[model samples]
Target: MRVLVTGHRGYIGSIVTPLLRAAGHDVVGLDSGLFALCLLGPAPENPPEFDVDLRDVTEAHLQGIDAVIHLAALSNDPLGSLAPQITHDINHHASVRLAHLAKNAGVRRFLYASTCSVYGSAGADLVREDAPLRPLTPYAESKVRVEDDVAAIADSGFSPVFLRNATAFGFSPCLRADIVLNNLVGRAVLTGKVRVLSDGTPWRPLVHVQDIAAAFTYALTAPTDKIHCAAYNVGTEANNMTVEQIAGAAADAVPGSTVLVTGDTGPDPRSYRVDFSAIRSAFDGYDPQWSVADGAAELYENYTRWGLTEYLFSERFTRLNHLEKLLAAGVLDASLRFQLIGAGCE
Candidate 1:
């Protein structure tokens, strides 16, 4: 299999790209490489790579790609809200546009990295793949729209598979601290402070970057009929846990770490739990294989050995906390967050 991965250098793509290669498939990574550090590793030297923004996607970009794995976007809910127009244009509109072009160009399989966040406030819904979608954020809305577009385009012969991924964690060279598990662990390791933004009650499902990579690796080889126009919520259902539970897990993962639940934290209305049985039934024996506790420990060990704590304490270099970095990715500008941050930095 020959696969073209967009946003190939971002958190999930970084992990998925390597797994695809190990699966004995030829991989061609296409990315803006903006959200991550300069992508390194071996390629065919001349293997396909691109820096085009999603909105500007052209036929030249789609030439000869067999399977398309679209992981490029604003990459988060808060960032999507940072610039709704750009989010809608790139994440929503351009994605559908790119898939359309790929379909026309004879791409056989299309894999999309959707999010479990789409089942916002799912409450006790158990979030099945067939559950009614109630997207609450621009990020979730873009995913919902793109999933719809992928399904529609499938009638035209594009076998689209949507992976509504669990909230991701774990270490990657493109380290992101915005995520719950990583942010908590990074803050604990670097500043000795684990700040809880929400009331420690909002349920966020956890998955490692490698597990997400595993899901994509499975999609790449799975029969087209099994995945075609189908969406699967990836990750363990039992992992749907509270912020505090995750915080404790991270704190326990690192030595001498302090977990702080700020009283100033307010309720996060977008809280919800999920069920992953549908995917297990579909892909039989689909195990997440990594728990939050295990992932936190892994992150802690890696950070300690790699000097990741130095960046966290510096403030300016923290991958997940710093918004200037996000802007540098063409998602936001430095002025936006600090300007917005002053209004309580929420």
Candidate 2:
């Protein structure tokens, strides 16, 4: 399989690109380099790459690509809320355009990295792939819109699979401290306290970053009859945990760290538990190995090794912070496009 992975330098993409290569697939990368400066550790050596944004991708870029694993977008709620229209442009409109281009260029498979966040606030119920979607934020709303549009275009020639991944947490070369487990562990190690901001009661399904990479690898060659236009929630039922439970896990991962519920009683309305049975049934060897405890421990060990400090907690490890800094510094324009200078932009 010759694969083209978008956002190949991102939190999950950095891990997924190497996984595809290790599995004997020829892989190429496409990224706009928005978060290229937001590095926590040494960057991974990527394959041949097209330094381009998702919105700028053309059918010419899809030539000879057997499949595309689309992971490019404004990835989180805060970033999406920062500019909702931009999020819709990139995450929804651009994504649908890419799928059409890929299909027109004879790309057989299109794997989309959707999110479990689409099942926002489905109180206490284990939501399945077919459950009514109620996206609370622009990020989740964009994902739902993309899933609908992409699925509508699926046909005998083009197979589109939607992997609605759980809240990803673990180590990557492009490490992110914005997500729940990573943020908790970073705070625990740096300040000896794990803080929960929202009264610690919102339910979230969490998955390790490596597990997400593995799931994408499986989808690359999954039976088209099984995965075509199918949406699969990608995490186990056992991993569905509340914010309080996650905080305890983070506290336990760091020695002598205490859990603090910081009076943020505004209970985040975006809480839901997901059912991942569809993925297990669809993929022959789908198995997610990392638990919340495992992810927290990994973050703690890596933070310690890297000598984490309060200063490192700025835009360097957080996506929203980094983008805001770029926009403020004029590196990225108001529309989130890079301003070309001296030599042409990469």
Candidate 3:
């Protein structure tokens, strides 16, 4: 399989790209190089890439690509809230366009990296792939839109699988400190405290980045009838934890660190317990092995070993803050597109 992985240098993509290669698939990359400089450690060995933005991807880039693992977008709620229009432009519009182009280019498989956040505020019930999608934020809404529009374009030749991944944790070379587990662990490592601004009552299903990579790797060659226009929640029931419980795991990972539920921001509405049974039933061999406790420990060890600091944690690793800084620095324009001044952007 020759695959074109969008956002191949991102937190999840950095890990997923290598796994696809190890599975004997030839991988090509397409990224805008927005976060190319936000490396916590050494840079990763990237695949041959078409250094272009998602909105600017041309038919030439899709030539000879067997499958496309679409992962590029305004990845989180805060990033989406920061610029909602751009979020829709890139995440929803560009994504649907890519699917049409892929199908026309003879790309057999289109794997979308959707989020479990689409099941926003489902309370105690475990929401399945067919559950009511109540997207609370622009980011989740964008994902929902992409899934609906892309699935409409699926046919006998083109199979679009939606992998609705949970809140991703664990460390990658292109580190992201904004996610729940990663943020809590980083705070504990740096400040000896795990602070939860929200009352710590919102339920968030967690999954390790490696496990997400494994899910995508499995989806690449899975039976077309099984995956075609199918949506699968990509986290185990075992990892469905509250914010306070996640903070507790972080505290346990770091000695002498205390968990603080501030309740400053009140309760977060982006809470959902996801059901992963569908994926398990389909891809029987794909079982998520990472627990919240294990992921917290892994993040702690990696953050310490890589020399994480408070400054970098607040500025570089956090996507919203980093993009804001880029915009202020004139490296990125109003629409979040990189200026051609930098070598990476060029």
Q: What is the TM-score of each candidate against the true structure?
A: 0.88, 0.97, 0.98
Ranking by TM-score: 3, 2, 1
**Clash pairs for candidate 3:** none
Q: Higher-lDDT candidate among 1 and 2?
A: 2
Query: Candidate 1 has what TM-score?
Result: 0.88
User: How far out, in Å, is residue 102 in model 3?
Assistant: 0.5
Each candidate's number of clashing pairs is 2, 0, 0
Q: How displaced is residue 261 in candidate 2, in Å?
A: 0.6
Output the number of the TM-score-best candidate: 3
User: lDDT per residue, candidate 3, 62-100, as tens digits?
Assistant: 999999999998899999999999999999999999999
True-structure lDDT of candidate 1: 0.76
Q: Sort all candidates by lDDT, best to worst.
A: 3, 2, 1
Candidate 2 lDDT by residue in tens digits, 1-346: 9999999988899999999999999999999987765566676888999999899999999999999999998999988999999999999999999999999999999999999999988988899988999999999999999999998988999999999999999988887888999999999998999988798888999999999999999999888988888999998888899999999999999999999998566788988998898899999999899999998999988899877777667557887888777777787899998885321111
Q: How much is 62 displaced in model 2, in angstroms?
A: 0.3
- What lDDT is reached at residue 261 by model 3? 92
Poorest lDDT segment (10 consecutive residues) of candidate 1: 337-346
| Tens-digit lDDT track of model 1 for 1-346 | 8888888777777788877887887787776545444211222222456755566778777778888989998778877877787788878888899888888888888889999989888775566787778889998999999988778868646788899999999887666767788878888887777778768888888788888988888787777666668888889976888988999998898888788888575977677777777677667456789998899999888778767745443343343345545455545454332222222111
